[model samples]
Target: MRTCMTVRHGAERRTLMMTGAKLVLMRHGQSLGNEANLFTGWNDLDLSANGHEEARRAGRLMRHHGFLFDAAHSSMLKRTIHTLHHCLDELDQSWLPEYRSWRLNERHYGALQGLNKDDTIARYGREQVQQWRRSFDVTPPAVKPDSPHHPGNDPRYASIPRCDLPCAESLAMTMKRVLPYWQDMLLPALRQGQSLLVITHGTVMRALIGHLDGLSPEETQTLEIPTGTPLVYEIDKAGAVHRIGYLLPPT
Candidate 1:
């Protein structure tokens, strides 16, 4: 049985009921940076061995749940790209059309990229680092143009207009870019009854989930998304998010 519910989104009131179409959002598996507890941001790093196993397990879990995706989306970063590949391969959906965008990348950690989280906390107080990391609106210090981690120097982002590239971004800023992609690309497909899969970063997933779930800024900051776990959302005909849960049962 499906339960109908109502959710408030700012000025609008929306009713939600169960629909067959689903939106599956998964954070990419642990990257090398993740293993090292570093702020990776836009720095492209390959998945670690454990990360590869995690991706496989995520795929097996989704397959067990009988989830089939019509299309997939991911950031240009290697971790996400490889994770998506491993998942689709397990599901035998490797041929599905995939869309990549810089908008789906992790929140730019700016000057903090490649730095150890503990070291940063030692240098800057824990509260300040937390603000830069989890706060909705507080951006970290900008990465200098010459910094290797700067997005401007990355070939993957070269096609993007210079003015649009960000040196540093808050979770709120990440939403600004992510929401447009959701509205312009993913939303329409969902409205047309497409089951979609999105592989992205932890912070990116947080921002997107925050928007779709209508979470407050403070609540959004507290949300924790684990790597390689599939977060499933069922949307109805009216495009309201009716139900959300993990594809895999909680361990």
Candidate 2:
């Protein structure tokens, strides 16, 4: 089902959308924290060696698909930004215009940013850790704006409206920021016949897919998008969502 469309409401004959604008969602590559199973959230770390390789692989995959996005969007964090850079490098279209916003950042793990996931689970209990990891609203305590871990003072946060910056965010809050960007910036491109690509963090990606697929808050956390993978959404004219899903590779 990853490669093929399953009819949702009607006998909407499915086919590859060749020319219409689309949304291509790509998660950032692995980081040192990811391999260590630490909570990164908005910690703004760089890609590991394997993460760099994953970015290159994504670029190759886009080239294989013959993909072209009119404009791109990414979070302010380095992993997401660098992932976009490497993806664009492989895409061979570095010149294509792009937009960066905080809306696409990974879910903010708050004070848990640098902590080990196993330790958190051990101390807080597995269920509580799971809630912090997946809950739509309850963001864990975060490093303060003055903390070394704070993402607010970073130049990347400059793009974000001040009211939204400096605070840790949950998947729900991410949606609040991202939706406006989509409706304000991205939707116009899609309507005007420009394919779009989104580079972002894990939980943010889930937030968007949740909105696109009509998943409930709890359901989005249950859905998994592998690290450094792509999720493509093909919408048609007349405001119809013809197809929306991930593209799985052969084993």
Candidate 3:
């Protein structure tokens, strides 16, 4: 049976289904870094041509499924921001309120930012690289504070505390930053019964999914999150969040 519930958006009120608040999580489409097989981290690269198409297709898929959102959130990175815009455009929801934060960014890769992944594997043994890439607590080497790859060098992060800036991060470290945003912002909004769209990076999305689904570190490491796919979840009244399915096949 279908039920309806009232949700508030600032001063505006919206009536939505009581099935539970729907939350959609998506990773940005292929970025230049991805196409070049580079360790992107938080380098803030733009999407490639194929990525643009992927974004549009993801949007169309959601629209075909009759998905609508009250608000959206994304990382401060342009790739995610652009993908969100493309998806919103296709859904005819360009006016939706958007919130962006650094906490939603990809794991900081430190000195690996522009290096080709294969080359890195060659320099560091495959097993070592794998550990850095897949281990829950093994962080990549830290970049020097003066390095161009460091977050401290970016003007966008000037307001952030100097101590909070990361030179490199493990999945565990990324989760530490991501969980706060979920607990402080997303969870409350979900409880308020507002449907939300979150466009973020692969590692950040994995961190979130790990928390929501209570996946172990090993399990999360093995999980592959495809880019440009919408992962839908329904939050019950008791505050449990579980996946419904992806809007597309998740290829």
Candidate 4:
């Protein structure tokens, strides 16, 4: 049976009628980038055929275990958005409120956005590529303002100030931007006793999970969140968050 507890959200107090507030943090299913082993960043690729299956399986797994969510969120990229929709469809909760934001997009890979991983490593040396891919503060080379790979060139980001768009992002830089969304969006919802599903990109997931778990920089750098697997967390009575393990065995 679910337990209930009184929680305070600012001046207002609400009764949370469950064991605790739960959250599902999932990386989007395999995209064209994953299938091709390319640096996708915010390239907005579509899901591969296997990606669709993985997302559906995640949904089925959640459903089998009686997971329910009050709202869902994803990055502005289609791979994540489509993965979310597929999961929601399988959950039979297609009408759930959905929020999307560029803040949740993958860590911008700058000039490396479309390059194959192996080729990039071959050209740049594996150590350099590894540093760019895994270091907490080492940003990849920046894309020129006029480069097609830059987010500034994308119509969807036109409304955002040019200064807010990233040319490249280290894991630290990605975490900096992602934290605001957590404070301004997800935190408020969680305080209201809401169960949420957040489907986003791999690097973004690492950044977020790192912050949520209060990991050291070295630990965060090595963290790996598998695509399409749901990592669960719970907020305790005192509002401290704890990892509850993944819902299904990662494929």
TM-score of each: 0.91, 0.87, 0.91, 0.91
Worst 10 residues of 4 by lDDT: 1-10
Candidate 4 per-residue lDDT over residues 20-93, each given as its tens digit:
67888999998989999999999989999999999998888777666778999999999999999999988999
Looking at model 3, report the run of 10 residues with the lowest lDDT sum.
1-10
- Inter-residue clash pairs, candidate 1: none
- Summed over model 4, clashes come to 0
Candidate 2 per-residue C-alpha lDDT over 136-203 given as tens digits, one digit per residue, 9 for 90 to 100:
88778767877767766677566656666646666787778678877788777777777788988778
Best by lDDT: 3
TM-score of 1: 0.91
RMSD of each: 5.2, 4.1, 6.7, 6.5
Candidate 1, residues 1-251, lDDT tens digits: the string is 24243433334455455446888899999899999999999999999999999999888777755677889999999999999999998888999999999999999999999999999999999999999999999999999988778888888889999789899999999989889999999888987888999999998898888899889999888888889988778776678875456554323
Ranking by TM-score: 3, 4, 1, 2
Off by over 4 Å in 2: 1-17, 158-161, 249-251
Better of 1 and 3 by TM-score: 3
Q: Model 2: number of clashes?
A: 3
Candidate 2 Cα deviation (angstroms), residue 250: 6.9
C-alpha lDDT values of all predictions? 0.86, 0.75, 0.87, 0.86
Candidate 3, residues 80-165, lDDT tens digits: the string is 99999999999999999999999999999988888999999999999999988889999999999999889988999999998998
